[model samples]
Target: MSETTAEKIPVTVLTGYLGAGKTTLLNRILSENHGKKYAVIVNEFGEIGIDNDLIIGADEEVFEMNNGCICCTVRGDLVRILDGLMKRKGKFDAIIVETTGLADPAPVAQTFFVDEDVQNNARLDAVVTVADAKWLSDRLKDAPEAKNQIAFADVIVLNKTDLVTPPELAEVEGRIRAINPYAKLHRTQRCQVALSDVLERGAFDLDRILELEPEFLAADEHDHDHEHCHDENCTHEHHHHDHDHHHDHDHGHGHGMKHYHDEDMQSLSLHSDKPLDPNKFMPWLQQLVATEGQKILRSKGILAFSGDDDRYVFQGVHMMLEGDHQRAWKEGEPRQSRLVFIGRELPEQTIRDGFERCIAA
Candidate 1:
């Protein structure tokens, strides 16, 4: 990557279900004096009603197909809007895209990966989802978009905790973890959180995973006491612990133990000690994504390819995948491969078997 592309503008996608405090979070982001200029792209102008120097209203005309997929239609409009933003180069340091309450984040996210121009000018920093603490459990059951928003999040702000008790907050958090174990969760009232927690997160950057979540590949941390309370009047029977994974990043945040289970949307993590045959792995991965794109919301991997000195890093949103040879393996560092997939009803065994077959002899 050239220095020009290396310094590509970071784009943050903000999404949530209806009445989930998205606008409140947007206002907070805009109002914060972080000494950075942001070019905001919002679904509707009047809805947010916020004054900013570089705010653009999106038409939100992208329609979903019969299968309820929105990526096909929104790609063109997003490309056009993003291209226009590139013209005003020095006006902003980063971009924030706020989707509608009912929007499916797949198409919005796919835009950053699928388009050549957009890819050159921008990189997806993270998908920050603001979810209503009191209503999220119900929304998860009644609204598919709600599930998608939570599943796609790199940072989830469970807002409006004042509306619910501590036990209820724990329940909502549990539901969220069941869907996406990888996302960093924050409990807040009125969408209030430290600005450092959400911006420049490097969520989509494959190399930054170690920096973001140091325990991502650690095996001992895998045994989390997963539990959840589905009933409204339920007691706090779930096991909770304070587990802090320190990062070199400035934001000092600790993650709590998370546990929950949802049949529709879930996350799968895979690891391999052996180097993989790229030729075999690539073809198998392509076929898997092609056949199960809709079910596969987000896929990321850092692989030890056979006969390669550099680490092979790849990530995908839906069917679109992008990868490259990242930094070289350090001397004596373990060269195991790690992969995590967050989506709906993934065929875990089939994927594991295919990945195992890709192991080099």
Candidate 2:
């Protein structure tokens, strides 16, 4: 017997309101004197790439091109772009997706769990929301997207702290605690926080999620009317799922009742007692990423492939992909493979069929 093949990959999503210094922060990270290499993807990246050029010399390893805006245009395409990047995975140490300020975090987070191509390659590091300390107090209350961004963030940066007073910062921090009390908060002047503090936070803990969304967990045990339906065998309960683990809390906070959703995102897990062929798995995953990518915000899992000693652990956010052979299985452990798909209103049977078709004998 051997252990299951699955590893968590870290992908940091950089989000904020317009002119909240997201690009500036990205530039600072890329230009850091550190030896690590990073792959970057941005909507209107060509325009932003120009800025990077102004700051540093050309390097293709830093990809800043657009298939479309990640939130809407290239919602499912992120995994494809990630697959291409993996062709040269050794050239970069990590991936950073800089999303448009006005976008919703749900769709972005959904990408990591739904796309097979991504689930085969990478893991979600964390969702980092960079907020303007002065403006966010108002934005969180008024903007729906702002609330969602905060709700999904693993790390929140109260940027531009220099411009605000200590009392104002304290007030903003209080509001954040009300919405998402679990996410780690960092005070930064112009988004200058240390990279180590933001990435791989894994702050969205199961205990916290259950506390915030027990209804979602309960819905699985007892049938309830839901906007989205999953397969009969599939349930969206977090704690009951094998993939559920005790992880750190991540996600932003601070919106009013208007920001709270009647429906939390849905998650469906597919477990196979057997191995899957990579050739069949790839196309089905790419198709899934292309078709329902927006609805399928995030997809991740560990896969056991036939005739392979090493297991594949993967993560996907929209079209972005990051995955690797995490490690060889340990002695006397079961080699079961499992995947978790989370999205807004996913059709469970559809996902199950797609996965079933990819099974190897």
Candidate topping lDDT: 1
| Tens digit of per-residue lDDT, candidate 1, span 141-251 | 999999999989988888998999766776787688778766777778999888888889998887786665432332213222132222222111111111122121212
Residue 263 local lDDT, model 1:
67
Q: What lDDT does candidate 1 reach at residue 150?
A: 94
- lDDT score, candidate 2: 0.60
* True-vs-predicted CA distance for residue 237, candidate 2, Å: 20
124 Cα displacement, candidate 1 (Å): 1.3
Residue 254 Cα positional deviation in candidate 2, in Å, after optimal superposition: 21
State residue 350's C-alpha deviation in candidate 2, in Å. Answer: 29
